[model samples]
Target: MAKTSKNKRTFKRKLINKYRLVILNEDTFEEKLTFKLTRLNVFIFGSLFSILLIVGTIFFIAFTPVKEYIPGYSSSKLNKKAADLVYKSDSLQQIVNVNTIYINQIKELLTGKIPEVIFDRDSILQTFHVDRDSVNLEPSNQDLEFRQQVEAVDRYSIFSEATKSADVVFFSPVKGTLTDGYDSQKRHYAVDIAVEVNTPVKSVADGTVIFAEWTAQTGHVIIVKHAGGYTSIYKHNTALHKQQGDLVKSGEVIASAGDTGELSTGPHLHFELWNEGYPVNPTNYIDFE
Candidate 1:
């Protein structure tokens, strides 16, 4: 018991004992600085300083933007910016997808490549709430009279002829000798109108230019999409006056003719007319003499 009590007192005295630390100049042994500290005070000061340093480090990392540079650390502002960018990219992708689909449809129209459809006759009739038995099969008196009037008109008359008897009138793109006419079996869907080089080619109808670009087979080609689903194409042009998306009136000069393509034998206008993705004979509506 005495030995234990003596050890405890020794420990306590050691903790409370004061120590003097001095800094001296070695030449003269002159004291420049001194510190009187107890072991307990030194230990307390060290522990408090360590705790303050740790807290300061944590505060700086947590509250300041410097933490973004540290590994395994992220900033809330960066997260928000990343999220915004992701949403913007998603929206832009959607817009691009929609535009691609629209352009594909236009290309299909230009190429006359119609997608096949499963025709459900019953479903179509039911959707329109029509009964086949109740529908009139005979033409009315006015319809017969109109048909007679249409048949009496000359087939080659540009003023009377329209697209399948529709009211739209087509103007001739160019008036010249027809070197070649539309032949579907040979896959020649356009009339090769032999015209002088640099002759002005006009639009067939009031429409908007949908395509105007150089092609390997057609050279400088321009396409116009008109109302009533009619589209006209002019190929082998020296220069185009209108660009894609330009609105044009009927008979407006859109391009100058040239023998520019690999298929061209001489300077002429290769003109094609299409209605609802099917090529139509341009002579049926226009007098390209």
Candidate 2:
């Protein structure tokens, strides 16, 4: 017990013990500086200093840009920029794929390779609502009167005198509301028909395709040369069914409507009629109700 008490006393004494450090001038033997410190105070001060240093380092790394320099650490700005670049690259790749498809279609047209025509019979029947069971044996009064007027005035015929009666028959190109009518003064030669997306565009008359290609202003445009110097133009299509040099029957599916070109506002078809190289109103000849 006595030895233990003595050890405790020595430990306490060491903890509180103080030492005087004096610096003296060598030549004059005069004291220049002196410091009085205890062992306990020195230890406490050193521990506090170490703790402050650690806290400062942690705060600097957490709040300052210097943390980006450390391995495995990334800057938020750089990460965001990388993500944006990846998105842009994906969009560019999609655009390239679309252009490639258009180019291949144009190449097939140039090579005189006609694409196979596929029709959605159900959609067509539903749109037109044609009743296959019913048949009108007798002509209506309106039809009889229209026939008389057509025969008397001959206003419906636009072809040459030799082919006027033969070329008077025309099939409606599409079933839609006419948004814009042909106006000679405004130079709007084509009639705009607004319709649902992927609606099939049909030919106005039996003709041979003379031009089928993509254009910057009109997108996928197809031109057909009919008998009696008549030509029909269909533009702003999503996909073309017939290529150049392909013979198309009246009311045959030629293309699908879409908003493809730069000038397009929505899915629609642009139809234009030309007679002897002069632009003519298509609505005058075909009744697209």
Candidate 3:
């Protein structure tokens, strides 16, 4: 016990031992600066300084832009820009895909390459499980009133006249027998007029051809934009006489009627008339008898 106590005293004395540090002028031998320090004080001061230095380095890296210079570190601005670029690239790719599809369809139309139709019997049968005999397909009173109001608004808006005076003359597209009538509930918003194959189909009014291309479901389709917010579509055509952007006079032959699409059962013209985006019965505008 005595020896241990003596050793502790020696260690404490060494830690507390005082030293004098002096800087003197070499020529004059005069002391310019002096410091009286103990071993313990020096060690404490050095440890404090090292701890402050480490803390300062951490603060500088965490709170300043210098952190961005470190390898594998990225700024918020650069990350955001990278994310935006990725989104824009994806959007551009989607647009390119859509345009490519349209271009391919146009090329097929120009080359007269109609795709062969493959009927999916299972898919068609899956959609027909409804009990057709029990369904009430007639429109309600409210539905009739809504349709009337819509028709009233369209007639006045297109002609700027009363309903009775809103009649506009339209040239018949073809002299044919009507095989099917317009049924919006069935999604068949056009009249199917059965005409002889290669029969000339005329434009119902003066218009510019907005789209003249072949589609997989509709074959050689032509859409015309006319004045008074009117539009016409002729589908299942074998050939189109007018290209997109061509202007045609009323009664001008625009396409030849034929069964060329997947939906066609025989040689016919699928004629649709639109007024401000709503489909209208073609029989109300043009006589197909």
lDDT of 3 by residue, 1-289 (tens): 9999999999999999999999999999999999999999999999999999999999999999999999999998999999999999987876666666656666776687967444343444445447889899999999999999888784323332122322456888999899999876676778999999999999999989999999988889999998877889999999999999999999999999999989889999999988777677777777889
Off by over 4 Å in 1: 1-163
**Candidate lDDT (C-alpha), each:** 0.87, 0.84, 0.85
TM-score each candidate: 0.44, 0.45, 0.44
Lowest summed lDDT window (length 10), candidate 1:
155-164
136-169 per-residue lDDT for model 1 (tens digits)? 9999999999999999986433322234664578
The window of 10 residues in a row where model 3 has the poorest summed lDDT is: 156-165
Model 1 TM-score? Answer: 0.44
lDDT of 2 by residue, 190-256 (tens): 8999998889999999999999999988899999999878889998999899999999999899999
Question: Top model by lDDT, which number?
Answer: 1
Scored against the true structure, residue 194 in model 1 reaches a CA lDDT of 95
Q: In model 1, what are the clashing residue pairs, if there are any?
A: none
Q: Superposing all C-alpha atoms, what RMSD in Å does each candidate have to the true structure?
A: 23.8, 24.8, 25.9
lDDT of 2 at 276: 72
